[model samples]
Target: MIDTATAPGSGGAPPAAPTRAGRRPATTSGPLRREYIWLALLLVGTGAAYLWNLTASGWANSFYAAAVQSGAKSWKAFFFGSSDWANAITVDKTPASLWPMELSARLFGFGSWTMLLPQVLLGVASVALLWAVVRRHFGANAGLLAGLALAVTPVAALMFRYNNPDALLVFLMIAAVWTMLRALDDGRWRWLVLCGLLVGFGFLAKQLQAGLVLPALALTYLFAGPPKLGKRIAQLFAAGAAMVAGAGWWVLVAQLWPASDRPYFGGSTNNSIIELTLGYNGLDRLGLGSGSGKPGGGGAPGGDPGGGVTAGVDLAAGGDMPQMHGGFHPFGGQAGITRLFNETVGGQIAWLIPAALILLVAAIILRGRAPRTDGKRAALLLLGGWGLVTGLVFSFMGGIFHEYYTVALAPALAGTIGAAGAVVWAERERRWVRAVLVLSVALTALTAFVLLSRTPDFVPWLRWLIVGVAVLAAAGLVLRGGRRLTIATLLAAVFVGLAAPTAYAVETLRQPHTGGIVKAGPATDSGFPGFPGGNRDAQSDPESGAAAPGGDAPGGATDAGGDADRERAGGGGPMGDEKPGDEVLALLEQDGSAYTWVAATISSNNAASYQLAADYPVMAIGGFGGGDPAPTLAQFQRDVTEGKIHYFIAGENHGPGGSSTSEGSKITAWVKDHYTATEVDGVTLYDLTATPKAG
Candidate 1:
């Protein structure tokens, strides 16, 4: 689709060509036309790979579940309801992660379409940006290849459809890149300002993660270009100021929420000056300070929830938990940042190393010392460095390990392939080499595809094909001098290109239900969705009916502001759940006057709505007529005694048996004696709000 519409020219940098922005159609024959054809095929392939995963993918369910849990309805529920509506009042520590969806929620309907649709579109935008960056900085063919490579990478494919912050992160990064490149192309300072604004928007989208790609681009520009030091520095400063202006407003507004509403978890502090600038971002990755994680944990989120010890001793309780700045924290030992980088790069780069090496060979052999065109080296340095740094830094961390972490490296890999492809195509002497390279590239990409398929154990023929591609890639790497080097690089491209198909064949042929009960997919049997917006923190809390971080079975006002006096009243004494406001679910389950649930948490209205779908089935007024959790306490108690609530479950990990704390009273004892357990959407069932069953 993009191919027919896009025309080249109207840009700057080395190897300058005539302005083609509005120029007549410049016809090319034989080789050039063939290259264009190849590019079009690759882009189509990329689009297919990314868009295909949208259906079978399981990544977006948790957010949907959380939205439901939060009592959010219509469109406003899904998008604005991060994790869940229960999280609305509670501070979430998933990096500075919700801004893009939050904005989307505000702009579009926050419900299903708002949360799910934007990601798909943004992902496509990222692909488009990648193409532009590669095409303008490098060449049209290179741009197409690079964009395709990114679009087809397994991680990129999954993430683009997954509805996570990472997809938006990619888009913001690409947007920033496109803006900056445009600025450079037209020598427009306004574009630089636009670049800065987008970069800052990137930060707002996901905080620290967005900065990785954008800053790297700037630094690369500063170091790799013509070295116009003064102008570059001034331009960068201006860009930075623009970015601050675009993104800084959010920080100010976030501050207005209670410091507790935006707790400085993972070391994000609300201290003076700097904290406001970076208080809620990926503070974990940046090393510890301002009440976040320390390097000992590899800059991962500190598993320990010590409420900042600076407050000295917990004068009130005097309990012996790790204390930081007078706050109480929890027990934790997580995968450190160092380990994160290794796994991300280690898992994916091995597939890429051979390709990168082969591409490099092509670069050196055909294009190295020869009369080079404009800005090629500078572009490679900038594009390659940013992709590598972003991927590597994230890989070294041990704490989190998701397959999609490799998206950051997409641009560079694409650049490398595009760079190599150009060299092989530019020279006529490398004809055979180019043929072999095409074959190998096709095989490697094919292999990757086979591996990622839902089913597996591919046909024997694929194994042979993989071996063939590998051999070609190796041969390409071997050639570095003149004709031989060009041949080797061409062989390499052919080798990598076919990897995905082989992988696909293998995955598709695997045994049915090979992995057992299907882990990461739909959970009609268990309402505990996969995403992390649970009322309780799944990391710390046990799944066995006892509540912790997100455990709140009753609907009561939860003060996220570390107000230890938090009451779990209705009949149970206050030993509330793990984190503050952690008992959102526990409170919601208790039967109330007129059966109204003033759901005060950040989860969606779905919890109430879905409950209506299941148990109440039909109701004149839904059981969850939203009210303040704190105010509804007494009525909730009366409703429970009147047999309003038969049971309740709350927390991040809760399904049948959720986590809980010791209650000072025996409200539970009465429940145990009178109520019978049942099931609703795989969640723990109780007769709450129902008349006690006859004995």
Candidate 2:
């Protein structure tokens, strides 16, 4: 967050002086020990707040779900942190954005849960970046305020705890921008190289989202600067190299892989690697999903379809969204080129989540507007744009829209929100306004804790008291200043107050088996992410609980143009109540070799029966006709003569992602005679797997 006045124009124009500083230097000197101290306090406070969410509740986000599914398919990939997540297991075309965790896993073998740590780790990094950016642009107080704001933001809180690419994306993007600014300012070639490398790697973490944030920020600065031409070009080129290093490896590999190996959807054609790669990650300015908007997440500019129905209706009738003209997107041009920002960044999130963001944004606009010359202002523009761009592009994903998608834009937004908190300090005169500032930060912190306190073990009353202390601590900051005694007391009070709630959260996570989520990769193909402390009791609640067996997906069933019945899904898992320890229930939650049967099977694995029947919703592949694979050649002939096995599945197992693996010629014969293929995912369904037997 460099102030423009101190930062030389990328276009070579000098920035305007601040109204408050009559003789502010073009370049400001620096802070002493206090700088690190306040930032450290900020870090400790934020860490305490988010640590509570470590095991608060729910499942791993879709990105991690895709990763964990991939992990299960190939242990080698899982162990080596493989990049082979090309739609073999999960539904998404490519989870290329999961490079960092894969790389970490390949290097470390702590299991899937380690992946979740990356989000928190990156969140910590984002706070650090905020501190650094704010320190450079504003002062320690402003930096501290920025850190405090980010710590409590609902979105920031979610991204920090949830397993997704956004948190990591935010960290890397900020790191890249911060480094790039440094590189350009001092003409340090090494920093530029670091910038390039960071950009490239961040690009890998969340596709082009991170890579573009830096350039976008730079170019935005250029908007403020008249044209310097040559210098701007050189700075961009140096930064470009950083992006290439981190993300370029994937491009080369995607090119070399055979076309058949890469059955990507979206706008990617298996032409050459470059075309596939670009369309996969770069194009679509507004596309959603890993490969989709990396084609069309952009919607019509200023198009606010009030709620999803209005958006869907507009897409259907307004000629505004893609219409099915000849079964294709009719609005397939530039309007379609960039996905709507309103949808991606502004649209998604819990209704309250958006409400909170609106509140923060409004607060900044009305009460907390920082000096225009402040570098924090520049940082805000950059981070704000980053969140807006990713949020807008990813929200329109036709298929999966997990909570982590919000992570992509979170870093920029978090730090900016924190800066907004500091804007409260800008009001030097009004005592009441400053009191409001203290109250706002405290309220924000309290709200975040309440929303995050969904875990069963945590006592709601205790959490409220912890929040009360944090509010008091925040109030202390205004009345005190740089006095060694007040600052130290204030710092300790603020941190401990925040830590109490957070500490309770972490302790609650220690108990395993509580209903929770894991990042298991695509079904059967691969899988896993996260630690194993859970308290999941996947049983029917006596009090208006879901079905005794697992119910349908909470976010709704993901039907990527396939046969899936939500009614059948609610009953997936054990037919009888889930026992104290149920592996099938666990497996059911993950993406794995899932096959559904309406009737029964020869296998005596009771858990399997309940698991398959209750957790997964696809129709059965056996016993519908004469028998799966047709009972025997003679039986098959009799059944065929009798017209049995109306539907069935055959062919090789194709490893994980292949067609149905159920075998035996008699099995195949019986299946065909008695059953008909119903609908399939990687599994085959039969209209009949068993004969009527004249019953």
The local lDDT score (0 to 100) that residue 35 gets in candidate 2 is: 55
Q: Every model's Cα RMSD, please?
A: 11.7, 12.9
**Candidate 2 residue lDDT tens string, 539-613:** 211211112112332222212211121112212221111121233334334443322222222111112223223
Give the candidate number with the greatest lDDT. 1
Please give the range of 10 consecutive residues that has the lowest summed lDDT in model 2: 519-528
Write down the lDDT of every candidate, Cα atoms only. Answer: 0.41, 0.39
lDDT of 2: 0.39
Candidate 1 per-residue lDDT, tens place, 397-429, comes to 322233345565655666666654554445423
